[model samples]
Target: MATMCLLNICLVLLFSTEIYSLDCKMLHLQQNKVNMKSLELLSKMGGQFPLQCLNENRNVGFLQKVLRPTESQKENAKLIILEIFQQIFNIFSKNLTQAAWDRSFIQSFQNGLYQQIEQLEKCLHSERENEIPYLGNEKILFPLLKLKKYFERIGDFLKEKQYSLCAWETIRWEMERCLLFVDQLTERLQN
Candidate 1:
């Protein structure tokens, strides 16, 4: 009777451990799926978002209220810009490295992104809309320029050893600080 009880207990423990490991594996897979979906949505939205902004319903209305183009908005826009770059960085890291460069895709992605950032900078500068200067006379142009430079460096870094992780880490670190700065600016704007 004692031997039977021990065997049952061991079997139960083993079964529970297997179940937990399976659950963890499933969770990780689901997380990857979600991330992939997000990246896909971003890619689609990248093309559509600017176009949507052009519609009459999009202009001079409640969006201005919700969007609230303050200094904080500019800052937040910068953060989102960085987030977009980081996502691209992650994609590159997953697929390309010192051994291989996804040159065509990277170039195209960066070009599109560069154009979008330029348009956003222009949007910030244009006085026709409810635009505000970001951080004194710097405007939104400075951050866009900086981000452009980073992309250029990333391209150069792709040729070097162990640079895949390094390139991603560099942008990732800056992105956090950018978020914090934007959050502070946002708080001030809210007040």
Candidate 2:
């Protein structure tokens, strides 16, 4: 019995130490603004956080392609914001794992992005003749402006080495706000 208990204790310690080591490495990489490839690798290695990937430099070509359908400058501005949201989603979804997913977390994240997408779609569909206005010019521009701050906060959290909890919270906050903004826009257009 004594030997068996000792073996279990040793295994637990070893696994915990391994997890801590991996988290430390992730913290280091996140702080450095490591490239996307490295971020992907760390995420694949069972890292639960997603702050590193979402904050990368925008892909100009991808943004242009995604926004090519819009003709009006105002609509195009909306598309630009949408494109950024999509990029953040792509990065975030790629990094998450089953263990990282909580129902509350996923629902909150999904709802936020869905809301933003809905808003943009509504504006595009409803404002057929009138200029929809650039997002920067919108009456409720505070939401998108808040999103920019979330991105910065995520970056700052990574910099501060709050790898495990802060990073996840940052991701959650960004997703929630973005979705809400989109949802508001969509609902407005439909009515």
Candidate 3:
């Protein structure tokens, strides 16, 4: 039942990346930890998700509409970016408890996600004496609210399946897409 409200900012400055040019690719280059390019690793060691996992909880194009590059998206880029990460954290964390998996698999993803989230958060806080403001403009707000519902649906779906291996498999599939989307967004992100 964990939710991803803004966590406390890690006061350390060196952990930050530029908000305008978040280099997720750089995250993968770390020699000793889980690579952020998880899709590459997963694909290399390929296995198909169960057939039951194939029927996805459709997002009604809300995710596309939000992430689609537009003037409005540009204006509210920071909030959109944060929202994406928040959703990722929420799903990934929920899966940690709801889905039983090998310890190494779950822990690695959790650690990688936390590191990425904290880096973004630290960057957002770099200019401010306090936390980043929780903005509420409709441009991002509506889509974010929509995305939130989609994520909640995912959580509900997980419970509905009694946290089956297939249920977790479906979630893992979704999360792979989510993380890949984040990586793509990181490439194009601008101030």
Q: Best candidate, lDDT-wise? A: 3
lDDT of 1: 0.38
Clashing pairs in 3: none
Ranking by lDDT: 3, 2, 1
**Residue pairs in candidate 2 whose N, alpha carbon or C atoms collide under 3 angstroms:** 112-179, 113-179, 115-182, 115-183, 116-182, 116-183, 118-186, 119-185, 119-186
lDDT of 1 by residue, 1-191 (tens): 64564355345434543443343223223223323333333343222223322331211112122222352253455343434435454434443443232343344334333333343344334433575544454645554555555445444544442444444333333333433343433343223
Per-residue lDDT of model 2, residues 1-191, tens digit only: 64564355345434543443343223222212212222233333334445564664322222222222222133234554565455465545543443354433343333334434444455445554466555555533543454455555555544454344445544544444443443333232222
TM-score of each: 0.30, 0.32, 0.64
Q: Which candidate number maximizes TM-score?
A: 3
Better of 2 and 3 by TM-score: 3
The RMSD (Cα, Å) of candidate 1 is 20.3
Report the alpha-carbon TM-score of model 3 versus the true structure: 0.64
Each prediction's RMSD to truth: 20.3, 18.1, 8.0
Question: In model 3, how large is the Cα lDDT of residue 31?
Answer: 13
lDDT at residue 62 of model 3 (Cα atoms): 40
TM-score rank order: 3, 2, 1
